[model samples]
Target: MDVNGDLVHGATLTAVLDGSTQPVGLLGALSQAHRIQRLELPVHTMLPVVLRQLMLPIMLDELKAPRDRREWGDRFNRGQFSADELERLEHYLGPHGYGDRFRLFDAERPFAQVAGLKALNGETKSVAQLVPSVASGNNVPIFSALCEADELRLEPGDAVLWLLHAHCWDTASIKTGAEGDPQASKGKTTGNPTGPLGQLGLVVPTGRTLYETLLLNTPVVPDGLAPDDRPHWAWDERPIGLGCNSPAAPAWSQRPATGLLDLLTFQARRVRMFTCETEQGLRVNRVIVSAGDRLTRTPEYDPHTVWQHVTKPKKNQPHQRPRRHISGRAAWQGLSTLLAMDLPEQSDGPYTSLLLRQIGDLRADEMLSEHYRLGAETSGLEYGTQSAVVENAIGDDLPLPVQALLAQDAWLREALLECVDQADQAARALDTLNNDLRRAAGGDPLPRDKGSKPSAQFLQSLDRTMRRLLVGLRTVGADESELLERGQLAWEQSVWHAATSDAGLLLAAAPPRAIVGRTVRNGNKDFVYRSGKASGLFRARLTDILPRAAEERRAAQKEGAAA
Candidate 1:
């Protein structure tokens, strides 16, 4: 029978029957002739039917095409022809003939002939010669034969066939010990021996490397001695166990399989994809449903529901790790600084408190010190305890409460008291001068000064003097006129005291938080005020005046209406 034309490369038949060059060559020629004739054959009846006739015993093996047919069809419909083009490839040779003379060749005969040639070419050796000798105790010949065969580019199938044939010959030559019958048991053994020809082991020719192929396809072979106990040939010695345990099986088994069905059913009802219709330009609500189920009802599927569901777990989760606590000293210091600073809005209070707590817990001062220490270490410079050094530097200049602690020494307290006494006496003298001018002005005297000199001019003179005194009291240094204008206008209308009234009494009773205040441009200079408590009280009094002024304006409007 002709063999070459039917043995196509990359086909399941070629893989099963064992392909050789001569058979491949014959197959290529036949395929070429068929193509030249432009003969059309049903895909199912094409090469498969011819392969069965060429190979004896007709072993049928099925192999997946390595790609999804439906997907390939879709691609082809979209003008892609890759799958079809790949199918047209002819990678084998066959007989050159036409009509009845041209016929499919048997692959087994040519493959056996090739195996003989391979053995003769030093690519393989007889099993008797390759097997380890009992006397020598070495399998060097076997290893050398296999190495040489592999180096010759012989296909694994061809090598296996050659070894099987050699093993059969070796078994035939072996003499079985019997009663005066050396030739009687020459070809026969007690075990039937199956001869090496039938002892051929199958090696699955996967594209992966040996290690990778074994890792991916090694089957759970049964542990037994009997040949009949083995699994089917298709499994390649692998046991007939479960193909593979489902990865999700353990988790799924922990629950019921119906759990997934339930989840999928629930999800299908709840989930939806947003789609827009270009025609109406109106948002139409739609319901989500499982496959084959109709979405007849219009149910609102808010996309925000997905976000809420997904984020809910993350949002409501409690932190798993332990949190650091803020030290009392650090918390107090941070809270003190926050309280002292004037924030832009009342809303900042909570934010500032949170920030202070965070900073305190993070050991901000210690972190700053460590950062400075690291910088100093890298640069080879001495950086002492930074916080301590800073505190020492500002010992006398910190906030009043802090400064008081630093000034616990007798000398520092004495110096501070003396300075306070001097400032108080100066402030008192200034108050007396302001009172004298207020008395001379009589209550609401002329809005501007008039008359140039002496008694008639004294009241006029007092107004000018008062203006100069007010300017001096408001100003610390340069541009006294500008300073007086910028001072709170409400203070100008305040009742003045001659070193004894409420203003004077308040100032004398308690010292201001700051004896002197500085402007952006002006350095530190004296400016009088009562205590922080008194300032707060004064602000409240000023706020109260707003309603009284409004009432007086209403009365004036009524009088005008009467007139």
Candidate 2:
């Protein structure tokens, strides 16, 4: 897809390789030249995860060359993939790359497919089963327009795309047990885990162009690839159905990954794609899917996610876990953790994504231009009921400033954190006012949504202002101190106005009869509800929460007093 959303057919992987086109996921690639701005596709939980999986092989191989790693961004900007590098990359993703292993319909060695699995499983399921969004078995879509009766069909290319998607994000429903697998109780395997990527709120750092996006996501690992480190395609042996249990194809077990390469291309399911010759062409119609290798634990460096330090409950041990993405929350709301900014007095700051840290380093080194905006694309899956149902797909893209990415300047960093802190307090103050207003009305002091609606709106109203502040701080000729001061005041005023207006609206809607006064017995004393009393309390709370607002009010009062 181009910037105009018109699909350009015959665009090769080499085009993306040479920076001729942009890569598209849920959040499309940011373009410096403003060429390919967005790419639209069906919204599914596993699509982006599969896309990342596809890119990992090339990224891992590129990481192997130390000298080239240093100049990755520069080379990418200047028509990516040098003569030798492109050839090496072609050896992996090219049509003849890796021999027949890359072939989709090769009976002996299919791409990411277990050969002869249809015979081993004794039956085949529809291709719809390969896609998570389509209605299949117990995993039905609520909002999906298609029904089970709908005849689902896929082209060879679409089949391959969904084939990889299934392996990365298949639900943990009971599966058809293969003939020779001992793990199956009654011709079925139960208790399979969700896909590894399914368990994470993936944070992919996207750059201005396709090539830059790839380099930004490919963070440098201090410890180079281990001797055993190799992607699935480079493995000595291929998956041969559920019965074949080796280091490469560990069926129904959590195995420790060899290294980054192994983890990136981790096959979570054993799948076989079957095609039938239709009048149109060769159409993929059925599949056989079973369990495959699962990662023992989250790897230390996934380059694409933020990890939080956590402790196990039963064993009471400390470990780092990938932080889960919260549905409906914007990425900027998590600025503290996203940028790894140090909180008030906490010695250990948030666990930042390695990719984000790498971007910061690039900015610091002046490799990536400080003026170019960075995009942090987050993708996550919300699961339900033993991980059998796809509950929701969580995704958001935040166009971040370079300073926000680095957060190295002490004053600038502190100022940003302060604005975030003040906004949070102001929201909290608004919530308190809501409860007070409810009390004045002699109703339940606590509302069901807990004032989340107003608080969310308040924060959202500040989004544009915050981005502007970020841009202003980096303005070429502006004084840093003056910009900081003005930005802080602007943020405080915005918060104050939004919070106060929300509170005023709530108070205005209250019933006058209830707000006049109400007295109820509380243990041995009388508890009174009155609008006047709540109003006074709310004023105090707002003034305390928004000191800058209070200072401006004081200055205005002094001017009026002199008059």
Candidate 3:
């Protein structure tokens, strides 16, 4: 035959019984089948080459004899064989016809070289030899379990041998003259010559051939095989053919199936490893569900709902914690207002006395009393028991003589008197306001039964106003004393006006009585004359009598000290 201009030889056949064929015929058969055109050889080869190829299996059989015979003989003698020895013997017997032949071959030589002659041919030595060895050797009987046992039984040692043989057979089939069944090489390499056994019409079965042999020979149970009895390489599931059924499928046919099976198996193992039948598993499941729910579900409320719930007060809510009281500039403004109210101002002599009386009507009397009470309370003392100590001390009241001396320097006199007047006025106003505050806060009302009528609430309000006014006066008295000491009490007109108008005696006095005036002169005929006697007498009583009495008492105390 010729293919694509390459010369093709026909298929070559050999008889298992005869070791004679031409090498040309064998090469021609391979060429025709593999579509090979030329032979890259040193020379053309002939018949003995073919015969040698045919004789390979027989030679392999002969070589297998000593190993098998020795193994079987040892087992018969010893009653047991190690796993390795048993495996070697089984492998030796798998391809050969019978134990008798193996023994005969062991006894014979060059019989393998003889064509058309069986080593065990009609010899009585053959039957007995076969019987005992077959009975003793752990081969056919053990492997028979592959066909008979419901589940394949394999020992650990057997599994190791099975894997080893599987790999070996696969490797050997590729290399020429390697020791595996020639029939097993049928579809392996394209141009390879079939072995003598293959030519004798034996077909190699895939998958289980090696595995089954090992399973039968091994003492251990083949626990790994319960899931699938198929050979290790073919155990994977694959898609069945959609096309026509032809020759055996390719080795790669099960790839997709094997991958899927492995994936499923891995998932099963993971499930077994990670899952628990407890609350912990429930928590894990909840966490997974929560994560997935967050990704997929719509929110039920606005995101700010939590913040609003925290900040907003509910209906009928209980009272909240009180904030700290902060009195800043407004408190100062209140003080200022109280300071600027109208009260009585200071005057000289009996006029000073009358001014003091009018200031008392402004309720400064009550404010002074309250101030004294508060001071005594703070100091843990009785009112009037402690001597009055002015917070901002001032110079003693100026006598008329001292006043006259200061008046000689008009500017200095005016400054000193102005300070005195301002202090007195501010004190009166603060006292009045203090009294008013007390009244407003429902303290003791002023006496309406003393020939006058006023609402009790009005009286109380007046007392509160008086209290505030007195507080302002006290503040100004202290401040003005400081200014005097610092020498900064300049009499600004506006301040004077505010001082006199708000808290001076003018506010308390009645309009003066209108008088017709006349002039008098010592030498002139007609002069205006006026009598100022009553006012002069009153002033004389205040300035001379009262002060003279005080001086007399002080002088007596000094005399007593001396004594």
- Give me the candidate number with maximum TM-score: 2
RMSD of each: 41.3, 5.4, 55.3
Query: What TM-score, computed on C-alpha atoms, does each candidate reach?
Result: 0.14, 0.83, 0.12
Scored by lDDT, model 2 comes in at: 0.65
> What lDDT does each candidate get?
0.22, 0.65, 0.22
Tens digit of lDDT per residue, candidate 2, span 1-563?
Answer: 22111111211122242334443321122222134432333453443554465655555654362333456556545644455655555454444555335566766666676766633448877778877777888878898667767768876656666777777777888877765456766667888888887877678776665555666666565566676666776766433432324422314466766677777777888787777777886677888887777777777767677867543323743356677788767666776777674322333235777677777777677777766767777878787889997888787776666665564654555667688788787777766666666666777766565445567787888788776766665542224676667667777778778877887887787789656868878799987778777767777887887787789989999999999
lDDT of 1 by residue, 105-155 (tens): 222222211101111112322222222221111222322335322312212
Q: What count of clashes does model 2 give?
A: 0
The residue pairs in collision within model 2 are: none
Off by over 4 Å in 2: 1-41, 44-51, 62-79, 94-96, 119-121, 237-252, 276-281, 311-318, 341-349, 447-453, 460-479, 520-527, 553-563
Candidate maximizing lDDT: 2
Models ranked on TM-score: 2, 1, 3
Better of 1 and 3 by lDDT: 1
- Of the two candidates 1 and 3, the one with more favorable TM-score, higher being better, is 1
Model 2 lDDT, residue 419, Cα = 80
Local distance difference test, candidate 3: 0.22
Which RMSD does model 2 reach against the true structure? 5.4
